[model samples]
Target: MSTFQYLLGICVAVVTFVIVIEMLRRRRLRERHAAWWLVAGALAIVVSVFPQLLDTAAGALGFDVPINLVFFVSLFVLFLVALQHSSELTELEAHNRAIVERLMVLELKLEHQLNEESQ
Candidate 1:
């Protein structure tokens, strides 16, 4: 292997090891989040080691060039993340509304009870 390839491989290995260690240390690296990063890292390592994989992926994805495929995939992942954020926001808003409504009902009941006791 060329010196550059060897250095690149070492860098990738170090990064992957560090990430895995971090995940273990945090103890919250659920499978869902880890899987995507693992897949992306693996794909990157594969492409770095075997350039042909990029060409094959590009051909399969019907992209005239390999970089286009990479960019498209990146954009898609970003969109998915945005969608997830929006969904979470909606759920939070709903929860807040429910809490507020419950609080209002409780306040009304307390006022009614107080009036009855006073009378």
Candidate 2:
């Protein structure tokens, strides 16, 4: 095996190990999410071990030049993360508005009671 291939395999292994550790620590990655990452990592490991897969995939995709698919996949994952954050922000905003409305109603009632007593 060439030194380049050996180095690629080591990098893939290290990334996969770190991902697994993070998923375990967070405990938020459901089976479906884990499955996707596992499949991606496995494919990467396989391709790194056998560099021929890169040529095959490039040919199948009709690209004369080799492209790194990982970049596209990472971008998609980042978009998903942003979407989830937006949804959470929306929910929090709605909850805060409801609380403010309730507080205003209580303040108005208290002021009316005080005025009636003074009169």
Candidate 3:
């Protein structure tokens, strides 16, 4: 990559890392999720500082172009993140259902008690 491109990448990586940290500090993002983003941002900085890492990885993976490998890795990371969020959502939904069922049972019991006390 050219000097300009390297500088730009570094700038972007720094900004992303800062943004992730700021978000975490402000409680805008949960640690469970922000951890992955932080890792990505740190990796971005590392790759920007040592651009040869991409070249080496691409060559090892038999990719003719390094940029394609970057895209592939990014997409794979996003896929895993999406899958994890999907599973978390499923668990949250189950918990919500259980809570609602318990609330309904409690409400019925309370109503029965109130009716008996009135009689």
- Please name the candidate that would achieve the greatest lDDT relative to the true structure: 3
User: All models: lDDT?
Assistant: 0.76, 0.73, 0.92
Candidate 3 per-residue lDDT, tens place, 8-28, comes to 999999999999999989999
- What number of clashing residue pairs does each candidate have, in the order they appear? 0, 0, 0
Worst 10 residues of 2 by lDDT: 65-74
Colliding pairs, model 3: none
- Among the numbered candidates, top TM-score falls to 3
Reference-based lDDT, residue 113, model 1: 100
Candidate 3 weakest lDDT stretch, 10 residues: 72-81
Per-residue error for 118 in candidate 3, Å, reads 3.3
Cα lDDT, model 1, residue 74: 66
- List TM-scores for all candidates, in order: 0.68, 0.55, 0.92
TM-score of 3: 0.92
Give, for candidate 1, the lowest lDDT window spanning 10 residues.
Answer: 30-39
Pick by TM-score: 2 or 3, better one? 3
- True-vs-predicted CA distance for residue 83, candidate 1, Å: 1.5
lDDT of 2 by residue, 18-106 (tens): 68658857996755446546666776677777677777877787667555554565577667767766887899999999999999999
